[model samples]
Target: MRRLSFAIATLLAATAMAPLAIARGPDGPAAPSAPVDKIVDEGTNRSEVMRVAQYLTDVIGARLTNSPGMRQAEDWTQAKFREWGLTNVHKEGFEFGRGWSAKNAGVKMIAPRPLTLIAAPLAWTPGTNGPITGQVVLAPMADEAALDQYKGKLKGKIVLLTEPTDITDATDPDFRRYGDADLDKADTFQLQNGGASANRRPSSASRMAFTAKRDAFLKAEGAIAYATMSSRNGKLVHGQNSQFQVGATPPLPGFEIAAEDYRRLTRLAKMGAAPSLELNSEVSYDDSDTKAYNILADIPGTDAKAGYVMAGAHMDSWAMGDGAADNAAGVSMVMEAARIIKASGIKTKRAIRFALWSGEEQGLLGSMAYVENHVASRPVDPALTGTNRYMNWSKAFPIKPGADHSKLAAYFNLDNGSGKIRGIYTQGNTAVVPIFREWLAPFNSMGATKVATGRTGSTDHVFFDAVGIPAFQFIQDPLDYGSNVHHTDVDTFDHLKPDDMRQGAIILATFLVNAANAPEPLPRLPLASEPKASDGFYAAPGAH
Candidate 1:
């Protein structure tokens, strides 16, 4: 299993970053007080976070964006919010090209050896032509010349292009939680520059050149399909696609087999047995129904004139798994926090809003759309952006009237995993250090004691943080999130711990209440040093 990178990158002004992201402060810098004991005790005693998590992951299954499951999950969320007394429950839509979902799929070894196989097709790829039979080929397609060598040779062939999974020894405990030392290590990380090569796409440049070569070769050779091995063990499938652009060419049918089964085919072909296989798949893009969704619910405040505090988690997930730890856990956590506070009868000066976002897996699409619609905007900042950057950065629009940018006091987000919350990421606004330290004080006994000054990325909070509002993501135990759960078929209800879920609910609810009743809004970063517009959700092919 690959190790998780705990280090955060240096803050950039384009995304509303404040220098290094953290420091230590001994006392409150005027943080308002809350009835933490009452909220914490009530939240800890009777919580349904896990129950809701189970319902979403086990019952509703994967909520892939714009899919039937996602649509149903949206309706379910609104129903639950209304059931929980959250008023003004509704859905907001955004325009995107299309949605993709996986249906029935199958693969098997039929000749030279007859056996059923554990495998799945990559999402958004073309499906097989009804279990077409083909001879297997171990075509590396190593370079442009190699791809040419396979010309006409791959006709009616099943091309194997990937290696078996890395079944390494457990150097570290996969099931264990984080220790104090781990938190200390993450807390003290230096904010490093996002170098020219810092965040380039995996296997970029050469990857694109070779991919274009291979795609052309496959199309010319009339290959049956492309098959690779799953990256994780036990037939857990993992895949992602970026060809959602309008008029993108139809991708060739692509499939992934279990690591062990993959090596079996490789061994047979290498030994000259020339095994043959069968594949059948069904998939389609929802181009006609391509509007994305973001679920919203408001707990109306008594002081109608006061600002509001917001919290949310993305509800979308990879279609292969139940999306238990990667996000359903987060979705339920936010829902339960709202329920806990409402049930605890914790009233505040500011309103609290709960959001369940979609299109997060497809490059923060839903959250960025939300920011464009509500909390964030691109006001004229002469110090940051020049004339050219303004026209090109389509996402950098100024906050519009009645968008409620001013009323938004703070936004808290959770999307790490099922681990217990250990602390908060200051996101480089050190003034909040003292305030968060105060908010987290109530949960010290529950093992959520630290408040780190690191910048965590690739989530919804960045959408809010991009506009200079106070936003944060909590630090949690890693567990097997990186190795086994994330984007894997094993991301199911079993990975979530009820105790951990309850603890997270208690801590975040208290934080929400404290923020809602705070004497002043959380301090904001004086816009970033020089805003240059975002590079994008993911680094471009030429970024390296």
Candidate 2:
């Protein structure tokens, strides 16, 4: 994760001015208020949330952007909102290019001994029509020179593009619990030996050079396909790292075989026993450029004149596993919260908007487009009379200036995983920290404590805050999300904690209700000049 800890510290320091004082009557702590009682007793229906989650994950399967599954999810969501009686319930259509779909995939080592190979296709890559058998070739084209060494010899063959790992020891703990510290140690271990002349490996430079060489090799020789081993154990974890630029030539179809399986073939080849593989996969591609869509729904307030409060979660997932915990959990939380509010018949003073966005796997494109089109001021005429007129007209042309600005009381988001809400990130919005404290008081019994004023990034909240909207993402405990579940085959319903999901729903519902009925809209901090970019923390290469 990136370090917004500095921003968090600043928010806490500023918010400390006014300690949140819980409301009290003349007697003492007053009895539970009507709103609080409503939330405590009837809010966060656990069974309903679990039911919806199962339907989306088990029945609908993976909802990759623009896939049939995503379209099905949209229809289900629209129907769900209508069933919940949400006002203005509909899928706001947007132009999206050809959708991609995966049917069946299989890989096997045929020669030297028959054995199944665990593998899966990368997103948007073309697939083999049927079983295609070919001799295996160890062609580590690490650089241009190495690539030239095997220039004319890779045709009609499965190219093994990575070094075969030494499988001498099978019980190394580093292989079992491969965390960040272990990864750093691995790099240092390599550096200790004078394997390479450079003291430190040039990872970025090496990757760029290797990519170019790989692409050239693939095109020069009509290779059958490209295959690499997943660094993890023997599991077909699907993912992609290529930057498929518009004009650049696409590489041969790519797939990741398990490390153990690849090692077996490599060992057999070293022993002079010719190894071969039969690979087959089905993938559909839409070449036309298409823009992804973001689903938005609103619950109009009883007082139609009030401001808006928003909540969101990225609906798209890496075409890997089922995308259960990485995001489906967060999406379910937001949906369930909206359902509870609408079901409880809470006619809030301010409207609440829920957005389940697509193309989040690309680069926050969906949210960025929404903000730019709806919030940012735009020139009316593309052919303007003068620069001054364009600038002058733009200043007064925000469609709904008040509503688009901080008129949003607050925007809450969930994306960490299916964990209980530990607390809320103030996102440097200091003025509203005390108010959140009061709002969170009712849920203390649910283990929702530790409120901090911090700014976290790599999520959709950044899109809102960039344009001066009061936005925040919650802090939840890391529960096997990073290593085991995230973008892995293990991210399924079994990993979800039912208790955690229910707790998060209750907390989020309460927070939104309080924000909706607050005496005034959440206060906004003065905008700061854009900060310079820095080589910060590690983020998933293609995460939205």
Candidate 3:
């Protein structure tokens, strides 16, 4: 009976120490770098990203950089950060030109037949005052050479920059959910010593100059407006307007007319008939403003001395329709991730910076500026402008890493689409492969289990990766973004799947929190050895 009593006392002692053992996760990173249960449960259960998205896309309207709507979005996001108890909430400024917004420009055919063509104004293009009539003229001035023939002849005329769209038969499905094979292909990665196959991506200054000269000559000729057909078919009217730079004069009105209408106009011009149309696309330009900003907020870490983890998405988007799918989804992702972390009161070793960048649609202008101001500064590579120059180019300027460059643990981006978190792109940082694999472990059921080295482009992450920082863009399902929705009027809230966005927000929150609590900082690729993201795409798999 005395031995049994002793045993009971020992059992009680063991039970008394159990809470300490339970505090540490089994076989997990030291401490709760990113407490999976806390992140996932709170992330998915209380998702605020989509609500932010609805306000940005549905309520505030399209957030074209420098536009009033974009300003409104900035105010709203900052207020949200303040309300969420995030500290260091403010804006950072950079030299920028003017902002532009559009009401609606009425463009329709009035001659050779009364046909109304659906039209959308490009961003910076000024509106044609009142109803201006001009006969359609086929002016394929691709360069200055083509402009010689039309000198003084294009006065008061609508010019078609190129021919009508060549409608190809739709072969593949519009929407796609990537399968295992596709993910496997994307997972493979290796850095080539030289370069890979060329894809005609050179942006030569001479070529640009020639094109610029042509535009100058066209403007000098007093053209009423410019019109072009969509590069892809099915009434997809792709357009851009912000050609006016800081000191440059205002842009001429332009229209991305329906492909069918462009074809009709060209056909009539080919025949003896004359085709005419009315154009009015006025834009609100912010001539007085010389600078723009990115919204910045932070959740102070318990260990402030350990540096920080950063996450951001561009707030600026194409003026066409609402910029929902192209980026409103992404902006919401990071913002929502920040919200989740702050709301859950997740403790971390590192602070988290949530950034909402502007002027992303304008060639990563906002992010690049931010990098120059805060992260690193390098001379502009004229060759880098060319699609062909994306490879085989060395740093043109010495990099002056910013004070915060070393302290920046990593930057994560989300800009693909409203698809669920399928995978991640390591940008050839194999060291991160295993790390991401671990981060994605709990998300396997959500189908975010893959972490590949493939590279996807044309987003703000390029700015981060360009500076030798370990920046990444998630590998999201296509969801017709490339084929149809991106940069089109159809890219609206309708295309977003809430469940997918919610899943993405939750996943992002976990990643951010984990990065903040990581025992070691992420490894960086030497600036010299790191190749362009384009090269990462074209290089043969496993061809180091």
Candidate 4:
């Protein structure tokens, strides 16, 4: 394994740019830093990172929470950790709802003219057994009043829940660029109605209601299945446009049909031609609730009693695509970083933990559980009284606190995309900005200059930060992720950039090494005394 050469050059260049008091060669005063050999070495290679990423994305495919693929991913990751000589390699499991997986799916139109349709089953959706044809109906339950109109009417029909979007060539240049203003404006643009009521976009609440009603109608009126048109043109894009069925019963077989086919069906239905079709699928769940597992591995520090530093990335992904860009890249990057550190054989003062979290797509559930159960100094059942048997056991033996980290150092996270890490987000922890600048200095030649003071949401790091842990998430170039690969069928192994991943791994590994060896831990902000729950975090408009 060959470490990144660019990283070394970048660090030297950054050192030249900054004015520092250092000793002259052999006989001068001691330099301000430790030897470079102790920071990084030539063992971290790009080939290995790419190989691991390929295995995860191309071999395992989509890893939706507790799906079979997710289990495979967990096993594979644990094996890799052990191979890397990491300690404390194990799976920390927690109970979650049983999730559904699709083996195969297909859609087609046999009416007026034959045409095959591109379709995918929504997560946790029930599948139709074999093929059954039915008339397609334009059922836009727009509002409560509109829903009332269809109280007992949709029976044995395919309901099209989405509205049609007016096709136009209006593209915003500002939106094409990456910046805060562009993001803000892009969000605002999504909320604007394009002059139609029945074509109004649906919200999360509306989608939930629609799912419930569709399922109820299917059960009562004997409907064969349900279908919705993909809103983003006729492209076979990927994303979970369905509701999260935690402990609820599975709904009727449902899928998102191609936009073109849906348009044809809607037009025919409007002309009283009653568009009908058949649907069939196979969906089942394991007997146990879906178990969310966090892959925990650590590189032991030379000082057995030193505090710990950590780096992480979510291992779970949306059910639609292979999840290459949305998170597989991040997972691979962090894992590669750890491998690099271990291969370099650098001894540090603080232990470094690498966590690959599951259930990130389902509201950061995995990280939240870990923090609540293992990070906080609280018991699971706080209601038990002192006289209770569960409590008396503590008197027999002192009840120790959870993973105490008043000595905890810092946590680094990467999840933006497959792009090279551009900089670090302090997440309002301004006191640590100068330290990150020093850490990032070594990567300036790799195009990682910007150091913004903004805060970011929608990733696993939020869990640690909420509980007073000094955590940070890196910033990266967009790299067509949002528009092309993110949560889309195009999110495959090919979308990943090996050079980018290599650069990220080296930078991350070097930073962790430096942080671990630093004389003092990175500065911390006032403890996050008020931790916000993940519920409703992404509920606001334009929230990811």
The candidate scoring highest on lDDT is 3
**TM, every model:** 0.83, 0.76, 0.87, 0.81
Q: Tell me how far candidate 1 lies from the true structure as C-alpha RMSD in angstroms.
A: 9.2
Q: In model 2, how large is the Cα lDDT of residue 207?
A: 60
> Against the correct fold, how does model 1 do in TM-score?
0.83
Q: Compute the lDDT of residue 449 as modeled in candidate 1.
A: 80
Task: Compute the lDDT of residue 181 as modeled in candidate 3.
Answer: 93
lDDT of 1 by residue, 1-544 (tens): 2221121011111212222112123443444455555554455556678778988988999877887788889999899999989988999997655667778888889978799988877766777757788989988765677776666788888999774444766576667778888887667544434221233335333554566667767878888788887766756676555444445545588888888788889989989998999888887677776687899999988798888999999999987789899899899899999998888787888999999998888767777767767765555343322112222223334444336778899999999988889999988787888778867764566678888877887888875776677899989888889878898888999998766776777677877887887777778875433333454367768976
Per-residue C-alpha lDDT of model 2 across residues 374-412, encoded as one tens digit per residue: 664333454322122212232223233323674576788
| Every model: Cα RMSD to truth | 9.2, 11.3, 8.8, 9.1
**Which regions in candidate 1 have their CA more than 4 angstroms from the true location?**
1-32, 141-146, 163-167, 192-213, 245-251, 377-403, 529-544
Score candidate 4 by lDDT: 0.69
Count of residue pairs whose backbone atoms collide, per candidate: 4, 2, 11, 10
Summarize candidate 4's per-residue lDDT along 162-227 as a digit string, tens digits: 765555663633113255553333222121122132123333444455657656755676556777
- Model 3 earns a TM-score of 0.87
- Stretches > 4 Å off in candidate 2: 1-34, 44-47, 93-96, 141-146, 164-213, 234-236, 241-251, 267-273, 286-289, 377-403, 531-544
Name the better of 1 and 4 by lDDT: 1
Worst 10 residues of 4 by lDDT: 386-395
Task: List runs of model 3 lying over 4 Å from the truth.
Answer: 1-29, 192-201, 204-208, 381-394, 529-544
Using TM-score, rank the candidates from best to worst: 3, 1, 4, 2
